[model samples]
Target: MVSRPHGGRLVRRVLPRDRLEDILRDSRGLHQLDVDDTIYRDLENIGYGVYSPLTGFLDSVELESVLLTMRLSNDLPWTIPIVLDIDEEARRSIGIGDTVLLRYGGQPVGLLMVEEVYRYDKRLYAEKVFKTTDPAHPGVARVMSMGDYLVGGSVEYIPMVRDGYEDYFLTPMETRVLFRERGWETVVAFQTRNVPHLGHEYVQKTALTFVDGLFINPVIGRKKRGDFRDEVILEAYKTLINRFYPRGSVVMSIVRYAMRYAGPREAIHHAVMRKNFGATHFIVGRDHAGVGNYYGRYEAQEIFSEFPDLGITPLFFREFFYCRGCGGMSNEKICPHDRDLRIYISGTRIRESLSRGVVPPGEMMRREVAETILSFENPFVE
Candidate 1:
C-alpha cells in the first residue's frame, strides 16, 4: 500500500478555475500584500498537497511548536517552519478573519485568510531552526533578512507563477495517481540538487532493486553558488533515465522548494514530502541537507529514529567510491580494497572538471551524463 500523507490526508487549497475567476472579479479592492518567488512556491506546494496537513502559513503557536519540538501543533513530525513574514506595521489595520491577497511578480498568486499576525525573535529562530546564528549559513542569512511579523492563515492558491521545467513538474496528487496507475506500491524517492554521478546511480539502483519503482525527485529552487542549475540537473537525469533504466520503472519530477540546509531536521522534512507523494521509502544520505561542517555525517540518519511513525522508510547507505580492485562503485560496507586503489566519487571534483571543459572520468559520472553537462556553457548557478 502507498504510505499515508503526513497529516493522514492530502490538502487541496487550490481554487478551481471558475471559482478563481469569480474571486478575481472583486480582486481590485481586496487588502493585498506582496511576497517573493519562494513564497509563491510555498503557496503552490501548500495548495497541491506537497505540504500536506498544513493548509496555511504557521501561526505563532504552530511556529513555536515546530521550532522547539520539531513537530506541528498537533504533534505530527514537522521540522522546517513554513511561515509568511511581513513588516510589523503591515498588519495594523488588518484584523483576524480578514482576507489578504498575496501578489508575486505583479500578479495575484494566492489569498491568505488572516488568522493571526505575530512577532518573533530573529536570532532565536536562526538558532532553533538552523542551529546556528552565523550569517554565513544560508538558512541563517534568510532568517536575518525576514520581516518582523508573521501572518498565519489558510491559503487559496491561484496558480499564476510558472516555475521553470514545467514539462517535469508533478504535484503530490499527480505523483500518487501515477504511482497507483503504474502499480508501484513500493516506490523509493531519491532527492538531489546536484547532477547525478555513478555514486548516485549505484545507490539509487541498489534501492530500486527492493522497490517497485524509483521516483527521481529533484529539489529545484534558489540553490547556492556552484550548485548545478535546475535545468542541468533535470536534463542530465532525463538522459540517464532514458538511456539506462528499464522502461516504466522510473518517474522523473521536480519539487520547487527552496533548500533550508538545516541538516537533520531537513531530512525528516524531506521524508514527509516524499511520503505525501506516495513513496514508501526515502533515501537519506550522509550530511543530508547539511552545509559546510555544521553537522555530523550520520546526524540525518540518526534523526529518523525519533520519528518511528514517519511513514516513509529511510534507506541509509554508507558513502560510496569507485574501487579499482572491484572495478565498480562500492561503499565501506562492501568493498575491502585498499585505499590506494579507490577513486572516491567527489561532486566537487566533477564540478571542477566540467568547469574546466574536462569530462570527469567514467568512474565518477556516465559518459553520456558528462557530455550532457558539458554541453551547457555555464551549468552552475551564478
Candidate 2:
C-alpha cells in the first residue's frame, strides 16, 4: 500500500474560491510584502500538499531545527527549511503578530500571519544545508543573495495562475488520486532535473520492475546555467514516455519547486516530497542532486541511513554504464566487465555534446529523444 503522508496528513491550505473575495478585501490596508517567483512557488507547493505538514513558512525554531537536525521542530524528517526572507526595512515595518499579504506581480498569492521575524547567518546556513560556504556553489550563492531577515508564520495559500505547462502540473493530492485510479499502491518516484538518458531509464525501469508504477516528478523552475530549459526537459520526457515506456506503467508530472543542489540534504528533501505524493518507494541514483565535486558520488545514498524512519523506501542504484561484455546496461552491482570495457552514460557529457549540436549514440540516448532535444535552437537554461 502507498505510505501515509510524511506527517500523517497532507497540507492543502489553498484558499477556497468563495472565501477569496473576503480574504482579498481584508488583506488591503495591511502590510504588503512583495515576493518573487521563487517564494510564490513555495507557497503554491505548500498549498498543494507538495510540502505536506508544513502549513506555512518555518519560524525561528523550525528553521534552527532543520538546519541543525535535518528535521522539523516536531521531529519529523524535513531536510530543507522553507522560509520567506525580507529586507531589514520590511522586517522593522512588518512587525510580529501582524497580518501581511504576499504579493507577486501585483497579485495576492498568499497571506502570512506574522508570528516571528528573525535574521539568520548566511555563511552558517550555507555550510549547514549545503556542506559548503563556497560562493560558486549555486545553493550557497542563493543563500548569499537572501534578504536580511526571515519571515515565519502559518500561511493562507492563495493559488495563482501558473501559466504554461498546464498539462504537466499535478498537485500531490491530484497525483495520489491518479495513482489510486491506476491501482498503483506501490509507486516508485524518480526525481530528476536533466533530460532523460539511457542510464536514468535503466534505473527507473529497474525500479519499476519491482513497483506498481513509476513517477517521473521533474522539478521545474529556476536552474543553473547549462541545465536543460524547463520546457525542453518536459518535452524530451514526453517523447521518451510516449515512445518507450509501457502504457499505463508510467506517469510524468512536474513539481514547480526551485532546485537547491544540496546533494545529500536535497536528496532527503526530494524523498520527503515524493513520499507526500503517495510514492511508496524513491530512487536515489549516483550523485543524486549533486553539483560539481561538492558531494561524494555515494553520499546522497549513504545519508539515507540517518533516517530509518523517513517512511519512504529509498532504492539506491550504483552508476550504470554500457558494458561491452554484458551487451547491455549494467551497474557495479551486477556487471563483471572491467572499467575499460564500459561506456559510462554521463549527463554532463551528454549535455556538452548536445550543446555543440551533436546527437549522442543510441547506446547513450535514444535517437527519438535526442532529436526532440536538438529541435530546440538552444535547450539549456541561459
The numbered model that scores best in lDDT is: 1
Q: What is the lDDT of residue 302 in candidate 1?
A: 99
Candidate 2 deviant stretches above 4 angstroms: none
Q: For model 2, how does the per-residue alpha-carbon lDDT over 19-116 read when each residue is reduced to its tens digit?
A: 88887877768899889777889898888888989999999999999999999988899999898999888877988899888898889888899999
TM-score of 2: 0.95
Clashing pairs in 1: none
Supply candidate 2's per-residue lDDT for 381: 80
Across 1-382, the per-residue lDDT of candidate 1 in tens digits comes to: 7889888999999988997887789987788889986788888889999899999999999999999999998889999999998986677767789998899988888989999989998898899888899999988998899888899999989887776578888888888889999998899999998899998998999999999999998887877789899899988998999999999999999888878899999999999989999999999988999999888999999999999988889999889898999988899889998999999998889999999999899889999999998899899899
Candidate 1 segments whose C-alpha is farther than 4 A from its true place: none
- The alpha-carbon lDDT assigned to residue 126 of candidate 2 equals 95
Model 1 TM: 0.97
Give the Cα lDDT of each candidate. Answer: 0.90, 0.90
TM per model? 0.97, 0.95
